[model samples]
Target: MKNQFDQKWLDEVAVVALGCSLPGSYPSREALLDAAIGAIEAGDLKVVGRSSWWASAAWPDPTAPAYRNGVVLVETPLPASEILARLHRIETHFGRVRIDSNAPRTLDLDLIAQGRTVTEVGLVLPHPRAHERLFVMGPLAEISPEWRHPVSGRTAADLAAAATVGSDAAPDIAKT
Candidate 1:
């Protein structure tokens, strides 16, 4: 039983990414990168691609401030549970809180997509709201502009354009 379980687990795959947002505890991109790189090095994950961008927050949460965010693409041969566990550990290490859905976080590591498979176990892939945020789109578009969402068949760019409901000047940030 143990050997069978181990082999099954090793056959899994996950889509992973590194995203940075501020008012985070860390200051510069390098600082965030250091933390991200550290996590990747410590885990059974593969670094596929990465991108970055900046956007002001929408008004519903007035207390929290604007955020500068980024995206990373990672490929992992670990089960979804293992991938999420690792990401959760990294987020906790970076001081992320889960008080609310859109609450501010120090370092956010989300599983954007996983091998074209759709799941609702404990996580969702092509992240349910991924297409709805510019920060996500800007970076994803940078890396996977033509990458189609398994459910919608729309490109990352299309989702960014459709879900954006606010007006803010694009910040001076490097995306990709």
Candidate 2:
């Protein structure tokens, strides 16, 4: 029998990394992380790696509360759009209300990458800003040191290193 498969709904497995951060008082940093992990686990995403929490860099607002940031790597069968939607759902569950860009949020979940697939219209693959933010690169490098940017071909470690060199604004990452 010939293989029967639907190209439109085929499961596209991808190694996805999510950059999570929170700058709020309602849900503690640990609580936010636990909730995220719970959501990921509920979604049946296989947890491959995790990074230590770090303080957020002062961006868009230097006076904002110190944001705790981290990254999680998961092996998922969901497409990029579904993965992004799931992340948004989790954020909503955690009281994240998107009112403005760069606003102090209770939860911020960014879909940093989805394997090597590149799409720019609705969702940009290999996140456009991942290469520049140490907050994202630091944790990403810890979990996926060998992972390369699909567009730039630079390893996560390299990107993290570049983000830190001569940049006084780099986030202070604390080793836990």
Candidate 3:
């Protein structure tokens, strides 16, 4: 499903920043935002747009605390490897410890998509596993519902549709 699209998007659109908030040892949103902004600034991540929303009550991991996540649109001149490396640096700055795949985090900065470029060396464009994650799709839909998967040629709506938990379960994750 990823071969139909043109590669022009890569040269034009290099990076899109997506934000996720989690139960962290950090003090508050201001601190988290500062950490994120600092990373973007140091790595020269252009802030095209940004928005925040509390986590609904679905609570995927019953043992984990709720999260308030957001999305950011960015354009980076660096390649995926460099960008990912920079993102990790920012994550480290925020005290993001990788305990497990869905472990609670202080701040998770995911590289949702990098134009139409797709690779498996380390980073996957259009996020290889994006089709199955509601956490990523919900905030993304807010940013660009029509944003097409660069490689798969699938719309954000498609990925949202494929999410296992119905819309009913999402509100549970968003905090009021």
Per-candidate count of clashing residue pairs (backbone under 3 Å): 0, 0, 14
As for candidate 2, its clashing pairs are: none
Which residue segments of model 2 deviate by more than 4 Å?
1-27, 119-121, 164-175
Residue 19 lDDT in candidate 1: 49
TM-score of each model, paired residue for residue: 0.74, 0.79, 0.74
lDDT of each: 0.59, 0.64, 0.59
Candidate 2: TM-score? Answer: 0.79
- lDDT winner among the candidates? 2
Q: Which candidate wins on TM-score?
A: 2
* Whole-model alpha-carbon lDDT for candidate 3: 0.59
Candidate scoring better on TM-score of 1 and 3: 1
Deviation (Å) of 83 in candidate 2: 0.2
Writing each residue's lDDT as its tens digit, candidate 3 over 12-77 gives 454343344453555764357556765686656776545444353334565555555555556777
- Candidate 2 per-residue C-alpha lDDT over 20-110 given as tens digits, one digit per residue, 9 for 90 to 100: 3463454466566656777877975766567666666446666755566767776776778888888888888877888887777777777
Query: Candidates sorted by lDDT, descending order?
Result: 2, 1, 3
- Candidate order by decreasing TM-score: 2, 1, 3
lDDT of 1 by residue, 53-170 (tens): 5455634575675555555555666766677788888887777788875665566777777666655587667677777766666556665566666678786657666656323524
Error of 2 at 60 (Å): 1.6
